[model samples]
Target: MDYQIARHNMVENQVRTNKVTDPLVIAAMEEVPRELFLPEAKRGVAYVDEDIAVGGGRYAMEPMVIARLMQCAEIAETDVALIIGAGYGYGAALLSRVAETVVAVESDKDMTASAEATFQSANYDNVIVVEGDLAAGYPNQAPYNVIVFDGAVTEVPAGVLEQVSEGGRLLAVVRAEGKVGIARLYERENGVIGHRDLFDANIPYLPGFEPTESFVF
Candidate 1:
């Protein structure tokens, strides 16, 4: 397959057409070889419009959703980012270009290993893949200038928010209401965390981030 062409089309059609107008985000998305982050067999569908499973019940979110999150984060060149649930590291790769450093945490050992190999092969020296509990976040690299949840979650845990430095930004897809989910952008201000709903997205939820049941028989 002509991956370069497919990457370009994904950027133009799936991403740009969907209101992801940030030039920095667009350029980073266009440059990352997304197919490399997928399992060899799954690479065939890397640029598809929907999310694809990356093993252990985790998924790499749809390109448009990823692009929107990137735009919302407003990653600065000097920023250090933390990516929760870094599926196959595609999101980290994209963010690495926009942000100075990235710490991607993944709970699945296999996925973490693959992501590390992929990042190394791609020469993404600034992006580090760390094995850890996704919900716990990677606090050892605390005080991130930007934090992004790579998959949908029920809520942004306080632990994660506490890691964001003052004036830093965070973006996540929160499972909301009965229908579509809400894409939220959070900012740290005066030692407080505030968020704005940027858009609605229905990306697949990261396994452990789902909301708990109210009752069980």
Candidate 2:
């Protein structure tokens, strides 16, 4: 399928045109084989400008959305990252390339095992895929310099926000009013986290991370 060409097009067209100008992200996205994270049957559409479903209600986020989030996160070469809802580990792979280390938290054991296998196959040695609750974040590796949610969420849990290191960054597609989500970036400084709405994004919600319903009177 000339995947190299497809990857190039994805970066030059889908990503760059969408305000994702970080060279590290552009280079990482260009090199990482997106199809490797998808089921064999779905590899053909890996470069398409759409979210690729993996399984268990999780999806590999659309290329442009991911790229823009990464750019907004402002990843540093020495930063340690935590990826929530790792899914097929595509985002972890990309994060590993930009950051020094990436710890991916996933709820399903089978998915974690599969993600580990894919990481090994792809030689993503800086990534660790572990089975854990997506909403809980990976506190064992707490104080991460960067934390990224792989899908949209109604709100970022406080517990999850507490794990970011002082001066760290967190990026997510936060569900907003009008049934839409906004790509938001948060920075922690002086023990306080500040967020900025980056752009609008429509992505799948992470399984089990949805906010609990509140009864309306």
Candidate 3:
């Protein structure tokens, strides 16, 4: 299969048509070889419109959703970004093309190993895949210009939001169990963070971000 053509189609038919207009985001999506991020068996469906499983109960996220999230972040050439639960490193690779550096945090050991190998082979050196608690947000590299949750999350930890530098942005698909998800863009301004809903999405929940249960007395 001609991945180039398939990628182009994905960008045109799936992403661009869905209101993802950022030129840099589009360029990055087009340049990255997404198939390389997946297991060989899954590579055949790399450019498909839906999310694909990448092990440890995480999904790579749909292309349109990923592109919209990146677009909402408004990534810059010199920005330092962080991606939480970046399964298979596809989102990291896409962000690496537009940001100066990207810290991809994944809790699964095997997934991290595979992602690192994929990044190395693809020469996406700007992205650093680290194995750790996904909700912790890789605090060692705090003050990120862009923080992206590669999948749906029920809530954003305050500590994680604190990692965004003043004037930076955080993007995520916020959803509760048995409900529709909303893509949100959060911005830190003057040390205060606020968010606005961008769009609706229903991607899989990240492993550690499931909503907590409440009791009724």
Query: For candidate 3, lDDT tens digit of each residue in 1-217?
Result: 9999999999999999999898999999899988988888898999999999866687878999999889888889999999998778889999999999999998888889999998887788888999999888999999999999988999998989999999999998999888999999999999899999998999989987888888999
Instruction: State the lDDT at 139 in candidate 2.
Output: 95
Candidate 2 lDDT tens digits, 118-180: 999778899989998888999998999999999999899999999999999999999843478
Q: What TM-score, over all chains together, does every model reach?
A: 0.97, 0.95, 0.97
Candidate lDDT (C-alpha), each? 0.91, 0.89, 0.91
Candidate 2 Cα errors over 4 Å, as ranges = 211-217
Q: List the residue pairs that clash in candidate 3.
A: none
lDDT of 1 by residue, 1-217 (tens): 9999999999988998998899999999889999999999899999999999877888889999989898888889999999999988999999999999999999989889999998887799999999999888999999999999998998988988999999999999999546688999999999999999988899888988887767767
Estimate the TM-score for candidate 1.
Answer: 0.97
Ranking by lDDT: 3, 1, 2
Model 2 vs truth, CA RMSD: 1.4
Query: Over all chains combined, what TM-score does candidate 2 have?
Result: 0.95
Worst 10 residues of 2 by lDDT: 205-214
Model 3 segments more than 4 A misplaced: 214-217
